[model samples]
Target: MSLQPDQAIEVFYSYAHEDEKVRDKLEKHLTLLRREGVITEWHDRKIGAGKEWQNEIDTHLNSSQIILLLVSANFIASDYCWDVEVKRAMERHETKEARVIPIILDFVDWESAPFGRLQALPEGGRAVKKWGNRDAAFLSVAQGIRIVAKELAVSS
Candidate 1:
């Protein structure tokens, strides 16, 4: 489905709860993108009271132009993250309604990832080592976001 002319570009950040640090970094980056008029992001961290989290997540997953999966060992380990976000995103992808961009925050066996066959960002040598030089990794992630935003713009 095409986004309305005035509808904001919705993005869902999927990651394991254990990887809070990486999630925080992604949130900061997405915030910057929002400030720059790139896209708006949704995540459990931004959920407020009085809202059904599951329904909210499904709504965003259905409406979002892209779902950025923060792939890591911890992310794949979380059943909720996989079943709720990753699987939902995959369904959307099957319908060609939304795109899933897997961002590698930590080394995960790509061949063994829950969502097999999805291409991940910064693969192989470009993969980021834990707590090492994060700048390059963040830059790579930002680039991937830009690419998705550009695609969305063109498609819309």
Candidate 2:
């Protein structure tokens, strides 16, 4: 079940526009994995100039092996993230088609949210913004993603 050397795990990012900075920070931490070809990251910013945004997003969402939800008050309030992306991520997760990881980027009461029961990143649901060193938080997330990617490779 090992992945081919050139086979990159597809990771789709779901976040609110308000959380873009945090998402960008998190993406920075994933550069190593991306360069190593362990994962291929996708976000709305990657949409082509002529592509229909929603259709492009849905294509990536449906094909992603992993989905990262950047959780925040704004993200929770976002209709597209909460109603659409999260819903689709959950469906894929439940069907064993993809794994979903929710990373808390800001203080938010998301324990009652759809992905609440799942384990979150930065350890113990700590918000990345609240971390003493933000890089440490992103590092924790990166390590967790590495573990999941390895597991997925093995299982596949």
Candidate 3:
């Protein structure tokens, strides 16, 4: 699974619509990696008009090397997030086809969730919203994702 220097690792953003703003902030923090060709991210918002959204989502979810689960109360409450996206993301992670990292955006009782066993971002699984300085929180998340991106580039 060696990535060519020019091939940025594909990142699939699986999150509830309520978390878009926070997701965008994280994306902004990831600007350096995107600019340096380390990763490319895809989410539902990128789906073109007239496209089948579900099919498009499934396509990226199945193909991407990294699946980012943006977690929060709203995210967990969404049936689609809990049932389809999380279910498939965990399946891929278990098979070694992709890396699934949970990004805790808001505090939630998620220790029993399917992705609970995997390491979460933002340093110590602190909710991004609970941070005193939001940029600092995003920075922690971006750095962690950067590490995962580099790992995916190495021997596998």
Ranking of all predicted structures according to lDDT, beginning with the best and ending with the worst: 2, 3, 1
Tens digit of lDDT per residue, candidate 2, span 1-156?
234555779999999998888888899999888878789899999998999999999999999999999999999999999889999999999999999999999989999988999999988789998999999999999999999998887787
lDDT of 2 at 122: 83
Please report how far candidate 3 places residue 47 from its true position, in Å: 0.2
Q: Relative to the unseen true structure, what is the C-alpha lDDT of residue 28 in candidate 2, on a scale of 0 to 100?
A: 93
When 1 and 2 are scored with lDDT, the better candidate is 2
lDDT of 3 by residue, 45-147 (tens): 9999999999999999999999999999999999999999999999999999999999999889888998998899889999988999989999999999989
- State in Å the error of residue 68, model 3: 0.5
Model 3 pairs whose backbones collide? none
Model 1, 88-147: lDDT tens digits are 898888888888878777766755655567776654424566536687677677777777
* Over 4 Å off, model 1: 1-7, 123-125, 130-132
How high a TM-score does candidate 3 get? 0.95
Give the worst 10-residue stretch by lDDT in candidate 1.
122-131
Could you say which candidate leads in lDDT?
A: 2
Cα lDDT, all candidates: 0.74, 0.91, 0.91
Q: What stretches of model 2 exceed 4 Å from their correct place?
A: 1-6
Query: In candidate 3, which residue ranges exceed 4 Å CA deviation?
Result: 1-6
